[model samples]
Target chain A: MNRGFIYDTFNVVQQNKIMLVYQGEFNQDIAKSVLAMTERNLDFFGEDVSVKRKIFNVMVECLQNICKHAEHSDARLREAIFMIGMDKDTYFVTTGNHIANEHVVGLRSKLQEINQLDKEGLKKMYKGLVSNDKGLSEKGGAGLGLVDLARKSGEKLLYDFSAVDHCDTSFYSLLIKISKNKIIQ
Target chain B: MENLTIKATDDTPEVSFDTSGVMILSGRSLPEDAASFYNPLLQWLSDYGKSGVTNPVVFDMKLEYFNTASSKMLLDLFNELESVAKSGVDALVRWYYPEGDDDMQEAGEEYAELVEIRFEMLTY
Candidate 1:
């Protein structure tokens, strides 16, 4: 008997202690549902209020990044994948999406720039971006989602981009870790 | 114009704009379409501006969590209030954060830095 990709993915998620996995078209409605589910899961686990808030903040940015950046494939196909996993005292939030090849360079550079920054560096950059009148993106993002994710999680962003079979496209995956002990502020 | 009052929902905040020159926004604000939800609030601000609120407009913001989209809308709101203040009406913002939530506190501080309004931070 042979297991398919779905089976392998499931196995990997379970092995990684993923508490939730969502793969499909991501829109605002779906984001709301996912947040609600995470909220309930956090409550059930008796997580502290501040921990829950941190996770929720990071989750919003991750989901909205998918909604704002994911390449549109077939209207019905899965455009992205999101997962929340916990290992010991750390919780990991990961989002994977397809992007046009043309966007790969810019996205990679931006992530690299963010990864290189310390917390103070990121904070200064965030303030600069927010205050710069000319910095607003067409999507109204101001390119602050990733920065906020880093600032809130207080962790380096882990990301990867790989070429896909389809021409001019690649799959982009981003992982952020939040510690239970570092709750709030 | 009539005062505006919107009840809080899981994804939206409770908003109250009284004719007495008081506005309060409390609860979580993670609306699906933040623009749609905030546009009316902005419009109300415009109306309040024209109404010539002689009394100081006190805005109490006690939000636990808000998404990035809401963050942008908040800047817009503060900018509007700044304009209203410039027009000779006193506008003040009281930003409330949980005792230990540094992120929220920092966020409030950031907003204060971006706008010209009189912004004060309070811990709950």
Candidate 2:
């Protein structure tokens, strides 16, 4: 579909209060759109500078994760799916992507570990993981981006997995939210 | 005394370090090749330390997003700074994370715990 169509369609779905969503192929263009939408939403919703930067950072991390880990080898198909929205009290950012069931365990473990940690604990965990001399792993869960997102939001991650086609493939959706007041502060 | 500058890309940020009197690496750093990008920078810091500058060396990291390997490099970088601090030369490390980004702020604290330097969190 065309960019205007996609943007309008997303705009319609999010008309009630304040929201933005995009799907299909995440490239530099999509990244730019995401940035634009975020800035617009911040302006409409009265987001402070620091909060806008935090949201921007979170979106970049999520967009990069989708680009880096999508199961689709096709470059065109890889850069797809992104959404951002904000209502009176909260701003929500969500992205959907395809992945294999085998990778879910690793992703879950990482999220679980991050979810359990308080601010201090997360920092300690991040340090230990980074300092470990074992080196990098091929797949995800190096504890870098995930930790970064968790630290930025200071909110528990909301996520779900839906079976796609057969058991091997699944659609994963992740949501991040920040309170409007907190953004002002 | 060395000057290092690398442009930022979609996945990374610009880096600028000056070793004229103090050692400083300031800017967003999410390089594709974390090790390769940081190796030379770390080497310069090492050499400066070995040169016996005896002056306070400062490292300013204002990174947005860094992968696991990059995180490790940062740890190594700060550890080297800590070593220089112990060697009689004053070492002061400043970490800036947007005030609203608790994650980055906490990251500065984490590095503070692991390294011997006063880590300050700034909202930028």
Candidate 3:
């Protein structure tokens, strides 16, 4: 909110090649606006249809995850962030949000499990779980989105976590890389 | 039974399911409240099941994009239809995805594997 912080954040985004950065609480309307704005940016860049769809699909999962799982209270979670950046032949879709500390271990393990899979393995797992009703809830699946993100991006899931102050919560961040090249390899 | 039609929004797809036979769901489907958006359609399918429409029923899905939550609802929707198909009723799902988009195609393939009803994959 202050000039110094804004200046520092601006420099960081500039250095990172971030196309759009959003840092706030998320709701349905905000999620829609984020998608719309990102769509406009993608169109402005004249991105290919297939690539744009990939970005949008990842963005939807990330944003909805924030809405569904983030502990919204001030004591529990705060300042969720989402951003997309590009460098050379790769695009980065990143999200950071505060989650209850109790939930962090489960999510981290799930993501680690997803990161371990090769593309073929990921596909098989996705197909296997796509039918199972255990994690397939109305809110979202347990590890379904994470697996799908890996399958679509054809890259490892990059993620990190750090403890938050004054509460039993952790700030979890994930970065997904999508290659612009037609072939994944 | 009454027909069902829902207008599309930026976050939800348009749904047009008729008792006359063809059911179509198209456009984007990433609604935050997927349950609220899709429950009525599920209810309609239940009603259609009871009405016993002997004619062939085709469920056409033409979604451009949907999030994980909407994807689950889709599975629920397909499962409901599977029951209708099992009870001596003719039912099929025409899953259409844009050509060259392997992700959506693979998604359809996964869904096709789960349900017993006849499923078709066609590229637009």
Candidate 1 runs further than 4 Å off: A1-10, A76-78, A134-140
For model 3 chain A, give the 10-residue run with minimal summed lDDT: A135-144
Clash count, one per candidate: 2, 13, 0
Each candidate's B-chain TM-score, in sequence, is 0.97, 0.85, 0.97
Candidate No. with top DockQ = 3
Candidate 3 per-residue lDDT over residues B1-124, each given as its tens digit:
9889999987889999999878999999887777778899999998898897876789999998988777778998999998888776799999999988888888888888887878899999
User: Candidate 3, overall lDDT?
Assistant: 0.84
Q: Candidate 1: deviation at residue A154, Å?
A: 0.9
Candidate 3 clashing pairs, residues 3+ apart or interchain? none
Error of 1 at A24 (Å): 1.4
For model 3, the stretches where C-alpha displacement exceeds 4 angstroms are A1-6, A135-143, A182-185
Off by over 4 Å in 2: A1-12, A15-19, A27-33, A40-46, A74-79, A135-141, A183-185, B6-14, B61-70, B86-88, B96-105, B118-124
lDDT (10s digit) by residue, model 1, range B1-124: 7899999997899999887879999999876567788889999998888886677899999998888778878888888888889899888999999998889999999899889998899999
User: lDDT at A58 for candidate 1?
Assistant: 93
Model 1 - which docking category? medium
